[model samples]
Target: MRHRKAGNKLGRNHSHRRALLRNLVTSVVIEDRVETTVAKAKAVRPLVEKMITLGKRGDIHSRRQAAAFLQTPESVSRLFATVAPRYGDRQGGYLRIVRTGFRQGDGGEKAMIELLGAEQELGAKQQKRAEAKAKKREELERQLAEQGGNEEGGSEENA
Candidate 1:
């Protein structure tokens, strides 16, 4: 019987499957990348590419259609304002899925689905995070040093 069927059901009914795909598409648009199981990454790739195509159209009608399908208005806006423009000269193949090995719990294969040409943005974000972490570490060390100094001074006074 299962002759002409396409697209995996992902073990959910129609509504839940639609919702899950919408949320995944929204996350990919907003964050430029998402780490998920291979099956989900494969399932979401086409929808993300379709949204990017709509964004490239740059019309109100296309925007409305994308907004209706995507999970959030912010995703729609990002898709139009930032994500779409990056592919102005490109044709298709907007997304890429890279295998990242298997998950620990269920042994499902893991993959990272990301928009092409997003590496620079992701790198900048990573740099900012590293800088923030370094700053926090320094602050914590200063606080510990101050506490140690205070404790030594207090002990001396007690003596």
Candidate 2:
């Protein structure tokens, strides 16, 4: 059986795999969410946690290390500024992987990897959207009611 193999190969050579992981980590840091295969998500988790730990350190050396690993300069800054602070009092487990079913073509299992507390932001967005939708619906109904009233008044005057 397979033994002593600590990581998944992910069908890529060393350089390609490292690049992929860095891009995925950067995406997750900036957007706080990423949809990828379960294998990829699992592989990206540790690296991302390490970055967050570096962010927690908030030192020049840590920043340099993070910038070296991550894809973009912006992502490096965000990791230290926003993402790390969100988990200030917490210890580990900064990410959550939710299975989003399988890819249709290859049937590979897909998952969404997101930061733990992103749901609060998502919830606020949903609430705002619902409020706007309700306001629009109310306006439409009021317009319809006014149209019906006008039509009836006109018909009665004609009669």
Candidate 3:
């Protein structure tokens, strides 16, 4: 009975499924990587590749088409500017999906979907984020130490 109906329903109706895919595509376009359920990732892969294909087109009609499908203007611009350019020489297979693990709740399988040529950029961004977090932690610790020292000095003075 289920013939020619290619594509997972994901238990959602048509509109909801379209919206979910649109959001997922937008997130992947903006972040260059997104962790999602395996089915969702697989569903979004072709959509993202299509968007990149539109980006490669790099015309007004393509831009409008991308804007209509994607969530934000920023994603459209990034697709046209950053993501599309990276895949200019390549033909297809713009995105890759890697199985990460299963979610603790409900035991759903999780996978990471990412643009193919964005490994270096993603790595650098993650490293920068880690360094910033470390710097903030050090600053907070230094402030706490200074506060403790000041309190000790005051207590000694009172004594």
Candidate 4:
């Protein structure tokens, strides 16, 4: 029979599936990324994208709508204030999915779902930290070189 159905049931009823998707969407919004089953990631991608699209409006109705769907004021605020603004210039395709092998227990496929702009921010922070470390290392090397030169000159004078 299973002819007209397009989406996976995931062994859950209608309400349960909706709830699961909502929770997953909320987590993704709050954390900007999450490791989840590949099927779940594919299922929730459009929902998260639509929520971000709603957030782009930045209005009362849109906020309320997103809040209603996400069920948390904090997540809603973050989506509007932080997540959405980053994607304001871009069109669709707000989420990225990367396959990360399989779960060891049941051997289910695992994947990482992440918002596009969030990675850039993380990378920038890492880059800044790396740059700072590199500068400190260079300074230490210069100081050591100068000390070695001074020691050589002092020893020459003694000789």
Candidate 5:
């Protein structure tokens, strides 16, 4: 029986695995959303959270640590300036993973990992805008129908 293994190996050596995790974490911080295999997404979630936790500290050591892991100055800056602020009052759970079903090429399980608060707020705003647009379209159609009916009545009276 398998016992005491902490993480998914993804069939890579230690250095490669570390590099892969750092890249994944960096991309997640930069894009704020990523589509990836479910296993990798799950594995990278905690690493990204730790980076955000460090960013939240907003200290010199944390910045250096983040820079070392991220390997990009811009990404580190974004992590501290944009990402960390969003999670200010919250304690943990900085991400949300949604299963996106199977991938076509290899049939691997796919998922979308997104920073939680921003996506949810954006979704709400989009939904509201969509609803308003639909309502406006319906009102226009009603007015058009009313005008059409009036035109028809006038035509009949003229005939």
Candidate 6:
């Protein structure tokens, strides 16, 4: 007789479930996107929306409420400062979930939950990461080339 029972338990007790959701919401707020299990993403969706709604409020009370729920002060600040401002003039539906694939270990269905209208920020972040990786790769290759040249020269001198 599971009647009127709302929200998935996610196989955890109340305290654990609450903690998990809080962490997930905080991560989504700070990172703008998070890849997690589909069920978790779905469960955390409404909570994230609520946080954003509070952020939209942009008041002292709402800020306190958000700070109480979210894990870090930085996330609360970012939510109010950046995320909320970005969603101003929009009605709702601040986030979107896209099914990515199954996880390798347990085959759990995975999804990416992202804030709407964050493509530009995400793109820029990705570009920066790619550039850093390329720079590191180039540096490593140069070091390898120098080492190889030194080795060959040393061998010629020995001969």
Cα error, residue 15 of model 5, in Å, equals 1.4
Model 2: runs farther than 4 Å from truth? Answer: 1-5, 123-159
Predicted candidate 6 versus true structure: per-residue lDDT over 30-149, tens digit per residue: 999999999999999999999999999999999999999999999999999999999889888999999999999999999999999999999999999999999999999999999999
Better of 3 and 4 by TM-score: 3
State the local distance difference test value for candidate 2.
0.95
* Per-residue alpha-carbon lDDT of candidate 1 for residues 44-136, written as tens digits (9 for 90 to 100): 988999999999999999999998999788888999999999999999999999999999998999999999999999999999999999999
Clashes of 3: 0
TM-score of each: 0.96, 0.76, 0.96, 0.74, 0.73, 0.93
Clashing pairs in 1: none
When summed lDDT is taken over every stretch of 10 residues in candidate 1, the lowest stretch is 70-79
lDDT of 2 by residue, 76-135 (tens): 989998899999998999999999999999999999999999888768877999999999
Q: Identify the runs in model 5 with alpha carbons over 4 angstroms from their true place.
A: 1-4, 120-159
Better of 1 and 4 by TM-score: 1
lDDT tens digits, residue span 1-159, model 5: 669979999889999999989999998898788899999999999999999999999999999999989968999999999899998999999999999999999899999998987777557768999999999999999999999999999999999
Question: How many clashes in each structure?
Answer: 0, 0, 0, 0, 0, 0
State the weakest 10-residue window (summed lDDT) of model 2.
Answer: 117-126
Better of 4 and 5 by TM-score: 4
- Candidate 3: 10-residue stretch with minimal lDDT: 87-96
**Which window of ten consecutive residues has the lowest lDDT sum in model 4?**
117-126
How high a TM-score does candidate 1 get? 0.96
Candidate 3 on 46-79: residue-level lDDT in tens? 9999999999999999999999999999999999
Error of 1 at 25 (Å): 0.5
lDDT of 4 at 128: 95
Error of 6 at 150 (Å): 1.5
How do the residues 87-133 of candidate 4 rate in per-residue lDDT, one tens digit apiece? 88999999999999999999999999999979787687689999999
Report residue 68 deviation for candidate 2 (angstroms).
Answer: 0.3
